[model samples]
Structures are given as structure tokens and as C-alpha cells.
Target: MSGIFLKQADFFETNGILFETGGFFLKQAEFFLKQAEFFMKQSDFSEESIVKK
Candidate 1:
């Protein structure tokens, strides 16, 4: 029946949206982690420079 097909299509669409949102969050988290690592290294270098001076 047409109604059954529509329901199945809707279910698939919902799943697609959830997957896309999850992927976006994962990417954002990875980006923030990289930024944190870079900042940490920078802080360490600055501290070493001060100590040397």
C-alpha cells in the first residue's frame, strides 16, 4: 500500500538525519581536541622560554 511505503520512507529519512547529526558532532569534537593539543604545546614552549630567560 502507498501508506506503508510512505511510513518506511519516513523512517529512513529520520535515520539519515540522526546519522548526519552524529557525524557532525564527531567532527566538531575532533577539531576541538586538535585545538587543545596545539594550545598545550604552545603553552609548554612559552614556559620553557621564560625559564631559559
Candidate 2:
């Protein structure tokens, strides 16, 4: 009985760790995507200014 409970607890702990790691990676991906979008917009603006000139 105690052994089964211990196993269940261990499984939950591992799953929790995996979830936390996934969340961290997701945040990093979002940050990078935002940075890429910002750079793309900046480039487009520069291109427009050059064209106008």
C-alpha cells in the first residue's frame, strides 16, 4: 500500500518538473518571436524610408 502511494507521488513529481520545464521553454519561444517581429518591422520601416528618399 505504502509502496503504491510512493510510486504515485514520484510520478506526479516528475510530471510537475516536466510541465515547469515546458512552460519555461514556451516563454523563451514567445520572447524570441516578439524580438523577431520587432526586427522585421524595423527593417520594413527602414526600407520605406530609403524608398521615399
Q: Per-prediction count of colliding residue pairs?
A: 0, 0
The parts of candidate 2 lying over 4 Å away from their true place are 1-20
Give lDDT tens digits, candidate 2, residues 1-53: 23444444455556556787755555555555555566667778888999999
Candidate 1 — worst ten consecutive residues by lDDT sum? 1-10
Predictions in order: lDDT: 0.59, 0.59
**TM-scores for all predictions:** 0.61, 0.61
In model 1, where do residues sit more than 4 Å from their true spots?
1-20
lDDT of 1 at 26: 54
As a whole number from 0 to 100, the lDDT of residue 24 in candidate 2 is 55
